[model samples]
Target chain A: MGHNGKMIRKKDLTFLQKSYIPEILKGMRQTIAEMFKPKFTFRYPEERFRPNPSFRGRPVLVQENEVERCVACGLCSRVCPALAIEVQASETELEKERYPIKFEINMVRCIFCGFCEEVCPEEAIVMSNEYELVFSSQEEALFGKDRLLKSAEELKPRLEFLRLNR
Target chain B: MQSLLLISALKFVAFVAVVLLTVIMLVYAERRVSAFIQNRLGPNRVGPWGLLQAIVDVVKLLLKEDVVPRNAYKPVHDLAPIISIAVALSTFAIIPFGNTINVYGHEVKLMIADVNVGILYLLSITSLGVYGVTLAGWSSNNKYSLLGGLRSSAQMISYELSMGLSIIGVLMVSGTLRLDQIVLQQTKYLWGWMPAWNFLLQPVAFITFVVAAFAETNRLPFDLPEAEPELVGGYHTEYSGLKFGLFFLAEYANMITAGAVITTLFLGGWHLPFAENLGLSPLMLSLLQVLTFCVKMFFVMMFFIVVRWTIPRFRYDQLMNIGWKLMLPLTLVNVLVTGLVLLLIQ
Candidate 1:
């Protein structure tokens, strides 16, 4: 549609008139201007810059007292495009409650989509800012409940310190 | 045979050292330049300003498992990158880096070798580099790699014609293919005011040369060979480890070679502006000229990096069409016009 509307008259320059002389001048002028213009480079190492605030990183599981916030809704397992997340729900000891008995996330398969976080009704799963989670083996990346729970425990002191200071 | 063997061995060691050091530093420079352009700090952890980062990366790659895809041709997969790196390094032979210096008892030129047909040698060797890339892509048995190889070969062949033609104009004006002679020609001022560089007399040729050089080097805007979005990993999609590193080294070496050629041809190879007419001493002038050449080369290298960040890649068809249909015809016209002007003025 856009192509049909525009009727542009193109100047037909001859062999010499069109090609040689004009392109030479245009290119030179462009390069000369560029030489003087402020260079678009940042000296790294000595200087550093921050990443965007909302940058999505690795996913983390949240803890509420002794229990997890996840009621094992199974929304994440259904919505995950990569099929990386696994959650199995079973009736818990608490009143009329269900929770994930077997929850495993394969980091290798996970695309960091944040869909899992969005699908969690209890807000049990959240993506943390710690993006540097590389495992040497595939087995290590298959994060089970124990690892997630351990991470939550590790983050407790820092979270509380921030909360109290604020 | 023994003496020849000794000389060859010495030359090989020197050449290997230079190529490795230059590639490492060039990688660091590229990182720093890109970082500065993007307004971000680049590498800094391994050593001061991350000077040792390339080494660390090399070690990491060495330990990495060299993975060849199951369907890939083993022979071509291994041969491609080695050929790429070898051809790129071979061009360094004929480039005269610095003037002769007196050793303990003998005179030595800093350059490794000075072939009389240095320009032709460089062009031919550089042309062979395309074969490595093309073969790598073709033999990979991957669709994307094959497409990339095809695009690279076509683009390179098209631009190669123009690049050679553009330089013919410079060769005509200087009346010599010897790089040293060309630089000498540009040392004198025209009417004691203008620098007697080819850039002034044959500016048309210079532009064509620079643009075509960019294409030949597979730089941005013309970097259709490894257009990441469409070609995925391009010709080296199936390559990994040191094989991949060799390709990376070859690229930087090509950049250096292009910069050196441009300096030698248009910007007065290692010759200071108005050096001949100026009252400076011979030694002082030589030193100044070398420094000038280095500065010019540095600026050209910076231009390569800056342009890479600024411009978007050209479509495959657009790249080919521009090279063959536009640059080729224009360069031919440039030669004709330059010849006419020289004849008329005479």
Candidate 2:
């Protein structure tokens, strides 16, 4: 979307434009004015940024009542491009009948692509707004079921977003 | 005589300490001002408003390994930053910070050195600064460094002409080469109100001189030598640790000296307007004069930082064109006009 058209030649400039001083003064005034404008930088740790619901952060499994919403169908694990998700299905006495006995996510490999969330047949996995992820070692990066699961109330916004969109 | 020598030594120590401290503050100010202009908070973590960041940075640099490139010439590479820092620091000795005040029954002049040929000393000392950058570039054995050094030499030499010519306008008006005398000339009231500062008397010279100073100092818009995107740290590309820190210190020191020089020559150095009539004590007045000089120098430094953030670097051809075709001729004409006006008034 560009025109390979006429370019401004030196001769085309007016006396003011040719001088460069006026333009420089104009720019200086603009910069001086800009110095007073409120800054956009978050003071980071002290002042955290609250990202909008649309923002796709780290993927977390949604837990409802006393159990996770996942049916252990392996759809999410199969769809995870990074192969970060690991789920072991086991028979449950609850109404869902089958549940993941062992659910782990290698946070290091998780791309946060939301693909696993999209491919989930159950309304189980969703992207949460927890962007600050730091791990000291490879082992530290691996999330077990305890870390991976977020109570449905905690992930209400994301769950609601997925439900409304679907 | 011994007391005079001791006093001079004390002044030397005091001034160098102040200059070093100011350079650190100037670096921090430059970063903060640039960030403010760009709508971001820069380096506010190290201390209160990041005031101690530069001090911490110096310590960090000191602790880091002194890296020397395998292909680099050892002796000159070691010598360059020393030369730059030394030249930058020495230029400030001639700038009068206040009028002579009685200290312990002997009159002590405010500046470190009272050179009779102060202006000539300033010009010569500043001219030597180019050697440090040029030598740094040449010794590094890096193509980018060499280009930066070569550009710096060319820019400095070209701008030096206009800088000297512009100073001639001030010289003609003041009718003296001594910096203190020039300042004294400026303190006189024109029409009983406005100070007859060289900036007011020779505005064209002020403009040209300020422009040439910008070029000489290697600040942005005239910073072709250290254009980071092109030259990758310019002459200091191969320098690291303490050597790199010295160069950084020298650049900021050069800026302070330039600001001091400008304040001395044009803005009426240490001459706080109408303070003599305020009925203040001589000691208080003297202290206030020194304070005035510092405030003026600070504003000039701020202007330098602001201009750096505002203007984009000139194209190499445009830099040369401005230096030779525009600035040189303008300064020559300004000098001529100043001479004519002086003659007419007389």
Evaluated with DockQ, which candidate comes out highest?
2
Highest lDDT scorer: 2
Question: Which portions of model 2 show Cα errors greater than 4 Å?
Answer: A1-7
Clashing pairs in 1: A40-B37, A41-B36, A41-B37, A42-B35, A42-B36, A42-B37, A44-B41, A44-B42
In model 2, what is the error at residue A101, expressed in angstroms?
1.8
Scored on chain A only, each candidate's TM-score is 0.59, 0.91
Q: TM-scores, in order shown?
A: 0.69, 0.96
lDDT tens per residue, model 2, B182-258 = 99999999999999988999988998999999999999989999999999979999999999999999999999999
The worst-scoring run of ten residues by lDDT in candidate 1 chain B lies at: B97-106
Interface RMSD, Å, model 1: 5.8
**What part of the reference interface contacts, as a 0 to 1 fraction, does candidate 1 reproduce?**
0.17
Per-residue lDDT of model 1, residues B214-247, tens digit only:
8877888788889888889788887888888888
